[model samples]
Structure formats: structure tokens, C-alpha cells
Target: MGISVTHKKLKVELVGFRLSTPKHYKIDGVENIDIERYDHEIFSKYLSILLEQENVEIKKKIDNCSITLLDYSENEISSYAFGKLLVFKSGKRQRIVNEDDLTEGEFKNRDQGLKNEIHFVINKTTGVILVERDYEKIFKASLLNSFFYHNKNFIYDYVDEFNKLNYNKETKTSIEIHKNKLIYINPLPSQDLFDELEEFARIKRFKVTKKVEKKKNHGIDGCAKELEDILNKASNTSLGQNVVSIEYYMDERGKGLEMDSLKKMIQNIYQSHYYEDFIITGTNIDNDLKTLTKDNITKRFEFKIPVDIDGNYVDICILFDKLLFLIQEYIEEHFDLDDYYSDKVRNLIVNP
Candidate 1:
């Protein structure tokens, strides 16, 4: 019988970092290497330092991790390096079946292992690093910062310029969001108080007195007193305006309600002009759609790349190598080189 293999689509997203060297930095005993210059020697030395037992710790808990370089290639514009970072916990005790007895389990406890791998790409010239968003649990911006900080001889440092990945009205990339995943909302007034006051001249003008209680004593014979009260109330009553600028968030569980329900609620808030911020607590995103605007985004949205997966034990290093060039191409097509060198981005770097 032939074994059946299933193929599936895996979504790929990468985060970018602006690479720079601190002015005071040095490699080994040599003087500071210029940020503009890079060669194989510098890359080799940097990788050696990270492979050290002491320098491998990405964090307090992940100290036993190991890193391996799988492939490297470069062009006139950029040099690409692909690698795998492996984290494992050893000495886990578990019982196994004894081959001698079919019905009986292991006589002695044995060590079982737990492992995780994060595949990444580094573009030397662009100073951008790419890793899938799914591995966010094991890989984080702070973790990378801490890892680089662990080694003094590591010549290059990275600055995450994710906000630069903003999209305009003309962008072709599609963005999808779950209304249920939205956990927070902040609404700011878009109309001025004077705009609300203009309503006085437009309405019956006497409806404003609807809130006034019945007088204790009859002071006027007609609606003139009511009209006076209306005028006073209309002048003193707080004016309400519509909210335009708004923000939304997702909870720890990454869950939320239906988009239809969210839209209705927003419409109500916009008209009432009362509510501001909200913390929605849920643990599910049942459905998703491309309904959010750029203003509602907190982080630059993840870029989706499609990958083919085989239903077998995967060689992640090989897989990442194949995808590295594709990711580099995506970066080249979407990001502007000038943005990385802009004064604003430079100030964001530690040594600039």
C-alpha cells in the first residue's frame, strides 16, 4: 500500500529590523567596524559568538538554546543568511514500553525531550531580520535585544522599525481582522463643541426644556416660561459631538465577537458621544474579514506568504532556505530603502 501525503498552506509573516553598529562597538580586539562595511569575516565572527555556551541564552529560561547557520547567498544589493535557533529542555523523565514484554511497560524511567525551532533570515545590507509571526511565543523583539546584549563582541545591533510598514489607499496587500479579537476601543471627538451648539438653531429649540421638572409655583401663564427655560437649558446643557479617531485591541486569549455586532456598537457610540475606551474580554475569533481601516491598526499588519507543507517530519532549516529568497524579494518590493536611512529612523537606533 502506498502512503498518502497531504499538502497544506502555511502562512509566512516576517518582522523587520534596521541594522546598525554602535560607534563605540568593536569586534574582538579590533577597532570599531564601520556600519557601511560587511564581509564574510564579520559574519563568521558574529555567528561564533552566538554559538558559545554562555552567549546562547536568549533569556533566563532559554539559556540552553543552540543556533545553526543553514545557508548563505548574496547579491550586489544585499547578503542573505538563513539559520535555525533551537530551544530544548532535557532530563525529562518518562516511562517507555519494554520490547521484551508486549503487554508490560518500561522497567526504568528514561529521559524524554521537548524542543522548539525558530527559522529566520538576516539581510546584511538592509539590516532587516525576518521570522514567522507564529513563533512569537519563542521569539520576541525583547528576546533578540537581550540576546545581542549578552555578547560584547557581537558587532551589529538591530532596531525594529515596524511602524514604517504603514499602508496607503493604493496598497495591494489585503488585511483581515476579527471583530471578536478586538479587545479595546478608544474614541476621540471629531466635531468641536460649537458644532454641537449649532443644533439649537436647527431644532424646535423648546425640546431642550424636556428635562426641566414641573415648576413648584406657577410663574408664567403660557409656554413663554417653558420657552425661557428651554433657552436657558439650551445654552447651559453640555453639547455632544461625534467621535472620529478610534483605537481597538485584542485580549491575551486573542478572541472576540462578531463584526456585525461591533459595527453596530461603534455606530451607537459615535452617535451618543459618551463612551471612550473599552476592554473586551474573550478567548475566540470565530470569523474574520477585511473590514478594518489603517487607523484601527496598532502594529503594521503581518505580510502573508504562502508555503507548501508535507505531512512528515520537517527539516525546518531546508524549508527556511527555500523561503528566504522569497522573503527578501518581498522586502525589496514593499519597503523603501530611503526610509531606513531617514533621520527619524536613525535617531531610533541606539548609536545614531
Candidate 2:
């Protein structure tokens, strides 16, 4: 919840904007401001006021946080297109690529396969800031874009590091031998549950051939069950009960998700990727999310959106107090999937 550095530039984009006429309420600051009227002056002034409040809260959170507004001309906002490379702590800086870097293939936010692509939006009713794009796709691609394909474990490496900050238990490497020969080779310093499990499976001769990896999709078990089956083949070895498994972390219907704020301090703990999606819903959902320990907010932005699916309207309330847990959970599920093709399903990666 503590802050160090904050974002300086603010981007206003209307790329995927769809502003339908308000049916029930009128916009403030400008009299009778409706979708039909489309008063740019009144809307701009209202947005400035919101930003001013955010700036005040940001200054209070960080001693010397600085923020500046981007003055985009009318034409610029209309045809908004650019790279959004970013660098997190311990993360490599992403670079902007020329048009030649693009290829034909399907991937999340396949926005020309660019590493960094940022998009922002505002909610009409609540004035909350929102994003429709996959912030996670661009963020991960920024760190480790695939020349041919991606590895789910690549992103999990960073997510595991972040989970360490809260997980009280510490892990150290242990070497187990049978007879005089090396029967097991569970090794290394991290002792990350998944890492150890992956190696443990390998030690039991669970060979995950690269061919199976290229498959488009698998069950929640992914190739993990295949590894499990291989491990079962070697009765000489037994996996620890606590070993991480390739089980679906979220439910098939995504019933146990919530949202809250964790702020920039999360960067210090889990300096890898930031995913912005909202799948948690139900009454007082925001309150359920904030109940986690050591939660805090230290950013100047908001996201609001209404989703209409099958004629049902759903509103997402996000206050990101502790999100690394959710991110870790998603990574666990992704472990069973092809790194290149595991779509986040209803994970609704939202950014606010």
C-alpha cells in the first residue's frame, strides 16, 4: 500500500468508445449534457476535475509524486495508435518495434503482435476509469514475447516471486537419494512449489514432449495430467502431498472471485506483469475483495464499465487492495494450458 514512484503521463483514448445516449440520468457540470448533444467542452472540464481529485490523493500517498496531463489535439484523440512499452522492477524494458516485427497469427490483443499496447476508457454513469483490452497480454509480451510460442511458466516465475511477500512459509532446496545412485534430483534455491513440482515430475521421467505443447487447448489439467500419468508410471518415486498440481484454480463458472486495491507496492513484491481484468461479481463484491490483509491503494486512476451479456446487465466494482493472489491463481490454471493459447476465459482481466 506504500508508494514510491507514480505514473506521470495520462492518456485519453476513444478508440473502442461506444457512447450510447443515457436513458435515465443526466451528466453533471454541463446542463442537459447527453449522448446526443456530445458536449466536448463540458466533458473535458468534468474529466479535469476528476483528475485533480486523483492528483490530490496521489500527492498524499507519495511524498513527491508528480503527474502531468497530456494535451492531445482533437485529431490525435481520433486516430489513437502507439506503442506502450513499460519496465517493472527486475523486468526488462520493452522496446517499440517497426511494422516488420508483426506476423500473422492469433493471440490475445494480437494488436499487430506489438509488445506494449495500452488502451483506456471511462464509465458513463459512475465516472470510473476502465480498460477493455488485455493489459496482461501486452505486459507479458513486453517482458518475454514469443519468437514462435510462449511458456506459461515464464510468467509464473514472476508471479511466484510476488506470492513470496505474503506467504509466511519459506522454502529451501533439499536433495533426496535412494541407495548409492541418484534416484531423485529435486534441486535449486527458489523451491517454488510449481518449479519443484515441474522438476519433480521430470525426475520421475515425465517427459513433456514439445509436440504435445503445440496443441491449441487442453482441459484444466492441460499436459499436467500427462506428466502425472508419467509419474504414476514410475512407482519408485512418490510426489509430496503438498506439491503444486495442475488443477483449475478458479471454478468453471468463476464464482469465487473478488476485487480490491494493492497499489504500486505490489511492484516491489511481484515486479513482473500486471493484468487488468474483472471477473468477480455479486453483492458488495468490492467489500469482499478489500478484506485481505495489508491492502492499500496508491494510484490515480479509475475504471468503470457495464457488461450486457444475454440481456443481463452486470457492473464491475474494483478496488485493487490485493490482486497478486488472483494473478497467481490464474497462473496456476494456465500451467495446465498451452502458454501460447490459454485464453483467460471469464477471467475478465480488468484494469481500474
Candidate 3:
């Protein structure tokens, strides 16, 4: 069981909030989401819903309580996961598309306008409000119990609010909560949030296939195979050095000094030098020489080419792919690492 939280008179300062109105585009079977677009109508609609859910009457004076968040990242992921009160400024409108003029600039101009975006500053759930001043510390700090920080903890639109009171004198086990403007309602789900994100990210990840394929088993795998090989080699090396290396060589992995050694291993695989040394790949050495390099790596890791440079043929982009692919393919099928690689305790990672 976890420790029960206790709170005193939880004071609050309503900051501001902003909602994304992305210009969605599906280009070449990929999403191109543009979160910079400031849709006043969408923001107004979401605000209306939030206010209704809160059930608190917005006094005439506090009607303009919406304060644009002065500082935060405009990243698509950050907007959905953690909330923002991004303020956009109307710069020079550059292009016109589908009858709407696309403006090029919306960089934060606090002194330029009244509130364009509204991000709130509240200290109720989280001890420190996600204000413009202390965003750096709050963003990196480990505050799981903090409501504003752990937005995904509860499925709600806004931070869940609650009031806690001291234990009643008559009842030892009962805690009383008699506070005003403290209890809040559940959050209303946003409209098609993930769908918008999928498209946005798809556009961002759209890749152009290069016509680099020459023939099958023609030494290098060509463009397509090179991309695949590159991905595999990069992943395998990262897994081995960053993850597997640590499991086996915890002392080296844990220390900040080991990053250079591990990084070189990853670079070796990336640059088609996986057979350079056992340190770069993994525990197996015999299979590496038989299947990939066809030569044993010496104790000093002497420089030697793994394949016939003249015999190998492929797109200039993937001339080295042959050596890297063979090295990677051989290891994937036989990935048994011994504890000998790491200078740690015996049997630390005999087989990973």
C-alpha cells in the first residue's frame, strides 16, 4: 500500500489553456499534421465544453482569465500528452490554399496581443504549476503524484481536482472534505485525437524509395535491402551495446565513461565493420568469421576488409551493405553472448 496524501487549503491560480487545430493532410499514404494552425473556433468549442463540465459560473471579470502559455514546446506529441497554452502571433500571410491563407509565422509574441492561447497555472495537484518560468525543471523532474505532470494517470480533459480535510475528532478513520470550488467533473474526450496524430506523423515519416535494386544475391542487397540491413544493424548494435552490454557489462554501461566505447561499437555496425571486434557485435566469434567476415579478428582488432572490394557490386549507396548485412544476419540467427565479453562477475550474462 502507498502512503495516503494529506493537503491543506489548496490555493490555485487559473493560468490558461490551448487546443490544437491541425491542418491534416494525407500525402503519399502518410499523415502531415501541422499543429501551428491557431483555430479560434475549435479552441472556443473545447473551452465551452470544459466550462460546462466544471459547472463554475465564469464571473464577468474572470471571463478573460484565458492566459496564453508563454513558454513550451510546439511538438505534436507534447500537445496531446502534456497540455500547453501556446500563444501565436499573426505574421505575414505567405500562401493561399483551398481558399484559406496559410500564415508562415506564429512565434510567441507575449507583448504583441491579448490571449491567443490559454494555459493554466494551478498549484493544486502539482506543487509547482506548469508556468512559463519553471518549465525546464518540471519537464524533467520525477513527480508521478503531480496531477499536471502525470496527465495520463486519469482519463480526463483537465487535471482532476479534489479537496482534503483533517480527520474528524469523532471518527478516527474518516477524513472530511468540506471545501468550495474544489470538486471537479470528469474530462470530456477530445474529438479524433489519435487519428489526427497518425496522419501528422505519417507525413513526417514519408520516405521516397530509391530505384537501386540490381539483382538477387549480387553481393550487396541494393537500396531496399540496404535500408533494411541498416535498420537491423543499427537496432542490433544499440540493443547489444546499450541494453545487452549493460546487462553483461553493468560496470562499464553504468559509468558515463563507457558511452564512447559503446558508441564506437554501434558505429562499427552502422559503418559495416561489425566483424571488427567481438566488442562491436556480441558473444559469438566463430560463426561471425565463418558466415560474415570469413576471417578471425585478432586480439588488437587489426584493420582488415571483410569482403572482396572488387567482387562486391551494388548501388554506390550500398557498396558496404554486403559486409554489414552478412555480419548482422549471421548474428541474429545465433545471438548467444558469453560473460567473457564483460569484465564483471562470473555468469553475469552467460547467454543474452
TM-score of each: 0.36, 0.17, 0.16
Off by over 4 Å in 3: 1-81, 84-113, 120-126, 133-172, 181-352
Error (Å) of candidate 2 at residue 288 is 28
Using TM-score as the measure, the top candidate is 1
- The models' CA-based lDDT, in order, is 0.36, 0.24, 0.25
lDDT of 2 by residue, 1-352 (tens): 9876432332221112112211112122222212211112223332333344433232111111122222212233431211212211212333444456664443333122323233333322222222223333222211211210122222333333423432333332111111111011111112132222222111111112212222233321332322443233322321222222221122345443211111222222222111111111122322322111111111122233333432222422221211222223333443333421342211211111
Top-lDDT candidate index = 1
- Tens digits of per-residue lDDT for model 1, 36-64: 22123234445554555343243333343
Q: Which residue runs does candidate 1 get wrong by more than 4 Å?
A: 1-4, 10-13, 24-44, 52-78, 88-113, 133-136, 153-318, 334-352
Clashing pairs in 1: 180-256, 180-257, 183-249, 255-284
Q: Report how far off residue 201 is in candidate 2 (Å).
A: 37
Candidate no. 1 TM-score: 0.36
Instruction: Tally clashes: model 2.
Output: 19
How far residue 225's Cα lies from its native spot in candidate 2, in Å, is 48
